[model samples]
Target: MLDHLIGRPSDNWKRTQIILTLLASTYLLFNGRTYKLPRSLVVTNRILKQYAPWRIALGTWLLLYLTKHTDILLGLDAPDPLRRMYKRSYFRGTWVLTALDAGFFTAMSIKPAWLRHLLSVVFSFYYLVFADAAEDKTRRVRASITVEHMRTSWEKAASNPILSFFSSLMRPSMTLKKVIKVKRPESSERAQLPPVQVHLYYAGNLDDLPDQTSLLLHFPGGGFVSMPPPCHEDAIARWAVQTGNLICSVNYGKSPEYPYPWAVEECYDLYCKIVESNGKVLGYRGDKPLKIALVGDSAGGNLVTAVTLKILTHNQNLLTSSVSSSFVMTSSDTSASIHESQAIPLPAGLIAIYPCLNFDLSCWMSPSQISLMRAESTTSLNGKSISHLLESKDHMRHQSPLSVEPDLERKSLWRRAFGLEANHAKRGTSLEERIKFMPPSMTDLKGANTSMLPSAGFVPRLAMTSRMSFFNDRIIPPGLMRAMAILYLGPHSYPDFDTDYLLSPIVAPSSLLAQFPKLYMMCGEKDPFVDDTVIFAGRIRKAKRENSRKSHHPEGDSESVTVRIMEGMSHAFLQMIPFLPDGDRATKAIGRWAQQILSSDDDTKTSMTKSKSLSNVAAIVTNEKDMIYRRRMGLVDGLYAGINEDSS
Candidate 1:
């Protein structure tokens, strides 16, 4: 009779049992109230008020039932008729018991003032238990799409309240402005292009330089973020005068605001425009052009090389039709893969400084770690390991460069221009059809078109020569680089290019050296990045030799490439020049290197040669005066400061 009454599979039966049990628990709890209990036993009354017998029983039963029927609870199996009936009974019992516990607790707490005091203790204990369970469930549901909606709603509301307050307080702080001071060169020796508000500085006049020579395109390093400001004008102006070249320093858009492809495309667009406008003014007429090189430092170095590759792959018409030189990129990061390649570009000419690269969410610390961090030290955030976040299989693929396939047609064009057939070249087109359909390999072309494509076997043999080759490069590591290389070199693979193409060469000052005529690299003995630079120099030297052998061109033997290692200098010494005494050995060494690169008489030196000196010079010493001015102008202030000032 008891089993039939209690275990019946009826909804009303379950609800009735829950109500009866709740009433019995309430009566038992109050019955002891009339008899004064000891202080030690007082907690029992509070516990009883917080959790009635019915609630405890119902919760336990539900937990057990879910555990026993885990497959159906987890939606892993079809539910049997009996199981369905049991689940309904369990839900009804749990809901009724929970309502009773909540209602009774609320009512008792609202009654006598003494009861409220006792009930507060009971509620506190229950609150903790409930919070713990809620937190666990929240974590599991964090990845669910539904949670994102809730988060968005909360964020929107939170941001609104602070927005007006911040807006008012930010207005007065916006008075700072980045000043651009123009100091004309000693003479109008360097031609100055009309200032386009965007032009950072003017270097006198351009007409003074010889006609039909090389055009130097300079891209300064600021990690695709900050700029060197007007103080760099002295150095850049000196460079233009000394080299007798038309120099244009690009201030490309920077990231989090202008991220990824935006800066890259802007640089490429600017480059194309410069070549088109200046190629003729510089005296290169018709399809045959004069020497044009690209130069960049640090992040600019990455941009320069990536742009060069893009032009070579996508803008073949510009190369085949015009006369162009090599490229030079200095002290730049070349690792482009998402995984190992996230290493940020070191400051121009400073190897000790590492780039901040990873952007994974999991790289963030867990709640427990956060708590520990808060308790220990505020700076603990810097030491958190992103490796754990990057260890997931999904992250490995997402961060990898080879994960995405290149467009087939674009790949074919690039492969054909480079005089190398992709492994999958024959998959889509037959031999006869390929020969007939595809443009003739650049190897078979003459004159300007000879260098239209990169050297044969260049991509394939890259890893064999330098340990830092795509595969073995220390910053990149061998496994990831090799995997990417295989994918890029494979046939019909989608846009399988290396991210290194986005970084500057380890040896050169700028990626532009590949396109420019004269290029130089200066490394410090104590600098950690020195080894990679040495390896890079060796690779370029070998490539030059191979190209010379293939072409039999005496022009290839010129001193268009130079690599210098300064003794006793360290990374970021360039920025410390003002602090160093007049006779400081490091400062003198940097000045000397700067003078040598800027004053070199190698006519064959490409315009890109300026990158080595520009970056190295910038790193060796930054002008304190300029920094102060920048601060006064508030250009260096936090992000919103400038915006506030502008709005006001």
Candidate 2:
């Protein structure tokens, strides 16, 4: 397993990894993090740095480059040399990466701690840019398709001797059996047929899971495309452990192969299908059923919120039979009477981490502000725009064919993969004129409170002269901000994409928003989407206020929203959990929130179960339709006892 994890390197490569680690560590001892380096190695590294600067620097980079991308030139279908060379590094300790970065600084003879910190920060952030969406189809599909891609390709370790040297220090790709094992752990461990239909992670012993435990139905974030459940195993495991609950991080279908509504519908179908021993859907909690919480991060947050709104909006879309049989909340002849008292299976709570709720700049940001943002220092601080970044020689060499990024001729090869033809605008048409509208029913975007106040809270403090990798503690750089917008909205001008409630929860109806269960939402202070979360939370607050004023049972039905701004953090912080301290902090905070919400559910269940006996009897009488049963209980006689007794 250890050999497999270091990418199953060849006999020679194992020796190389040892050599590189020694060299890198020697460099770190001299120029390492400002900690007290071993005195002897420090003196040795300094002497070497003084004499052989370029030699050491370039050689280290060569080694680093080799370790990072051993299989770089090879096609995705290329055989073993142990699958992907450059991949996620944090699965094991980041020692190799640390050594590589330290060597770069040392070779430059850079001893300044601050500069080195800057370099490291840049290195980590670039992970978001380079690694995030870069390996779209080949590796991404490999994750979803499971072990076959990894297992079939391997023949021997020493395929390319030079590449093999670097391969030993690189992260491992999933093997055929390994992917299936982690992904469907229950199926692997259980002797009997698995009880649940999806991938599940139990906090402890599955048998120890209490009848009242809260189940977190997690939909992971991957820009609605890449990343499957296995990629999120560590973070999910931490959450499950911290919250001490059952978590089901599902493997939903990815996009550009299954776009827009496919992921959405998959998550929603799973939401509708999660069964409890008490005989209720995942989100439906009653007197007898366990509570469930809908949880997601980034694109996943969007999915859970959309699922919530869609059900609240067209709850009739759900069959009534799915709700719990033991406890039906509706008494009036709403859909309940005609539908046999079927109400939507509402999750007890929702936890969204930096959700990208609104893509329609017009709906959420002012036109001038939008223009200013789109035109900001995209090239200065963040380097090139995503479009230009993809055009680079190296980027082009490594890019996936199924990347969601725009392709040649301003065409979207990605859209074509999912059967969406790029809408070619007529020559000379303005961007506004190019947009096609959906029906008003879909586009009017009635309620989630998307109307912008026209005041920009803060645009990032990025300037044209700022270094590409520079950052403050409290803001996103203009370049990263713009690239993310392009990443999510793509290069297309679709007004309807912004207005569709599923794509942008900010456009969901206020009534639908009011129906959301308890919401705990957090955004990083430095995240580009800070304003989005703030604005969306304000909309929810405003909607709750309005709905409360109009409702007779406002206090009982009002939705609760909690907003948090994590200090010194950035967007999609959850993705950083295994690697960054801030990411782990954010994850723990969420676990705390999850614990709170689940505990409250337990309190509600306890109170409901403790309902007085007379009230329970009356509740049964209200639902009784059989005259004989009512008379047997004397409910019918009690109602007309005065007249009947007097006449007798």
* Candidate achieving the largest lDDT: 2
Give the per-residue lDDT digits (tens) of candidate 1, residues 1-648.
333667655657767778888899998877856347786668755776788789878987998978876875445664221221112323233223233233223333265755644453354345345643433332333323132222222122112233224333422221112232222222222225222212422233434333434455556554454453232333344444444455556655544345565566666655544444434432334233334445554355456555655554442333322212112122222221112101111111111122111111122233333222222122112111111111111111222222111112223444656787566544433222334443567434323311111233211110111122112111223332233233222343343132334433332322223333334444433233333344344444545555666677654633544555443332333322223231134334333444454344544332322233133223322333244445644754666786888899
> Candidate 2, residues 1-648: lDDT per residue as tens digits?
334567864657767778888899899767766347678867867777666678888988998988766654332233222122112332122332223222232222235644643454444344434532322322333333322222111111222233234433332222111111122222122224222234566556544544544677788876665566655655676777777676777667654455566666666655544421222332224345456778888778888888888667645333322323323333332223222322345677889887878665331234433323333213122212321221211112223322212233232445546677557662233222344864676464433322121223422211111112112211223433333345445444664854689878877767777656788888654454554565566566656777878875555432377777664344555544445566677778888988887778433331212233123333443354333333544865686897888899
As a whole number from 0 to 100, the lDDT of residue 69 in candidate 2 is 68
Highest TM-score against the true fold, candidate: 2
Quantify all predictions' global Cα lDDT against the true fold: 0.37, 0.50
TM-score of 1: 0.32
Error of 1 at 429 (Å): 64
**For residue 229, what is the lDDT in candidate 2?**
67
The C-alpha local distance difference test score for the whole of candidate 1 amounts to 0.37
Structural similarity to truth (TM-score) of each candidate:
0.32, 0.47
